[model samples]
Target: MPVTKATDADFRQLLDQHEKVVVKYYADWCGNCRLFSPKFKRLSEAEPEVAFLDVNAESSPEARKLANVTNLPYFAVFRNGELLETLAASKEEAVVELISKLHAN
Candidate 1:
């Protein structure tokens, strides 16, 4: 699925609608965030069934707080609206593998 920009207002409802969700937290000015975004998008395109959301940490304070994100390029996965894992790295392969394993179980 395409990545959707999100804020705190609709975050819960969005997650409720998807069986599998991946939310990415990043800041526009962060160099690392800039570097990781393309990889994040590629992963989203590869997994069309999963709901992908992005929260701009520098602009969306509410979203950052809701996701409890502390740093740039944070990633969280949810299954059936339940939080499964929150990862700090920007490794696309590892994230994709983890998602595959999680969905399989």
Candidate 2:
């Protein structure tokens, strides 16, 4: 699965369709976001059933607002279109935990 470029129009659709949706808020110029992109992609590939969406923080204001994102790279996990957990503090291990919990549910 490819990283989804999330916009205001498509964001809700992706959330509605997938059992688990992991949305990553990033910026094109942010170094942290750049470093995290590959990891996110690899995670998405490993879990093909999960929908991974990306919202460019610098460009997509609607998406950013919808997700209530403030950091350079923010992660939000939704199950059945309802937000299950949000992790914006930990580095990589946090994301792994989020994925694990999703699989468990």
Which structure among the candidates has the greatest lDDT? 2
Q: Against the hidden true structure, what lDDT does model 2 obtain?
A: 0.82
Each prediction's whole-model lDDT (CA)? 0.81, 0.82
lDDT of 1: 0.81
Candidate 2 C-alpha lDDT tens digits along 26-98: 8778888889988999989988889899888777787677668878788888899888777774388888888
Looking at model 1, the pairs that clash are: 1-48
Q: What root-mean-square deviation over C-alphas does model 1 reach?
A: 1.7
**Model 1, poorest ten-residue lDDT window?**
93-102
